[model samples]
Target: MKPLPSLDVLKTFLVVDQKLNFTRAADTLNVTQGAVSRQIDGLEAHLGYALFARQARGLALTQQGALLVAPLQQAFAQIGEALAKGAAQSGTLRVKCPTCAMRWVLPRVICLQNERPEIVVEVTASVSHGVDFSGEQFDAAIVFGTPSLKGVSTHHLFDEVLTPVCAPELWKARRGKMPTPGDLAGKTLLHPTRDRRDWLRWLNAYGYEGLPSTKAQHFDTLDLAISSAMQGLGVTIGDLSLIEEDLGARRVIAPFSLCVPSGAAYYLVYPERPAPSPALQHFAQWIEGEARHTRTHLAAYTKPIHQPIN
Candidate 1:
């Protein structure tokens, strides 16, 4: 293979070719004249030909250099095209979602990828705290509850409702009798540390003064807590939308007829300034559609066990 000119040399050549003056090219490139001359020298050495004829007034392109100009211009144009394509493929669409919704959102993200394969989606799971969109690398986020940031566009995704869930065997052991909130007094309660307040809010909404506290196991991760609940370690408050697959597969059963509004909903947030990219718009539309489908699916299959608080 033939040796190639370095990008630095090519860039210097292009600038000097355009200006026809070494000083002007050096000024444009923010480099000293010495550096520019060295780059041109290296470029000419590699090609085994003088690119420019030194003149008293300025510099003139040699016959060989004139011949190379058109091809180098085309080469640079092709390089630009490749760079744009790479940016489209690798440009990140950063997103943040609640830990509980990660399971539901990740699977649906596969569908988004099918629709727009060029954009990469980066997801960060958190409990909706300390999200700094301006300081962080995120281009967009899907957060639960209200976004505290001002001057950003926010779209409501869906309301999350909590329901009591346990393994099917646990339900069978109880002889198919659904437990009320009071009935949970004697049973173990698997709790997500982030949603600890949810239990209290739910109990308060039910008009229950105080319920018996059983042996409680706290899990930092929603998936781990859900898995532990599915194994009949204890009953857990679950988002019906997230656990629909486990419910459908009979891995878990709702042993309570009571449910409570979680006082939180999902939101899609982005900067209000710079208009969104085509990729961001496409993803937002797809996610909203999927969320609607999830709601409809939940309504059709899962019975509402809890009434909304007034």
Candidate 2:
């Protein structure tokens, strides 16, 4: 392949194309008119075509030069975009969050965007509960688990408070009576994990043996399982703090009133840099305040005396 002309010569051609006059183009490029002429001459020789025709009145673009103008302009515009995206001041904050936490994280993120219109927040939801910051391009992530991850700063959001929740229609199907631990015997049980670890933990804490394996439905993420339950598919163990809005709206009802605190919790995590980006810092502060508000909301729920489920 023939070597492309240098960026300097290509840029000179664009300036000349826009101004249509060598003197003005030279002035715009902060170069001498003779230098501009040499660049154009060199570019024409490389392409074996004259780009500009010297007219009695200024200059005119040859057919070949006109064709190159649009493509060159587009190429330069794309280069600018790539450079802006590589810089930290692009005004977009990319965040990764577990699918289960979207119920809690999504609304808060919308609120943050509304309050601070200057910053754009982009969220990626995944089934994985943790992130490898070294491999990902996210500015920050909301992680679910114990806050012991090394090389990252963590801000505790809320505990994984477990409780069985079902659609109001499902609960009302059994009449106005609230459900008990024994009521789960015949009802379909939704397991968030394939192994049913969350259900087992909560059941163990309540001193209640779990239901039969044949009556269970499994999902990859708690959010999916909870969504299915809200459709009256079954009763799923929900993290009470994350589902406060649903509980308040009566989309799902926690009839048992027994919230078991699993040892793990959700946290806002980011790499421990010497100086964090302003966008990350701003979001961290906002989310921490929101978390405090969530904790207050969860205070009313009855956390029965039970051993903490680890």
User: Which candidate leads in TM-score?
Assistant: 2
C-alpha lDDT values of all predictions: 0.73, 0.82
Q: lDDT, candidate 1, residue 88?
A: 45
Lowest summed-lDDT stretch of 10 residues in model 1?
Answer: 128-137
What is candidate 1's lDDT per residue for 1-310, written digit by digit as tens? 7767676688789779988999988876767899999999988888899999999999999999999888877776556445434434567677777677788888778767777778678788865433444334466777776567665788777777777788887654456564567667767888876556656656776667554465788887667778899888988778777887788888998765556766677778876545566787777888888878778877744455455554
The candidate that wins on lDDT is: 2
lDDT of 1: 0.73
Error of 2 at 262 (Å): 1.3
Q: RMSD per prediction, one decimal?
A: 17.0, 18.1
Q: On a 0 to 1 TM-score scale, where does candidate 1 land against the true structure?
A: 0.63
Residue 160 miss distance in model 1 (angstroms): 1.9
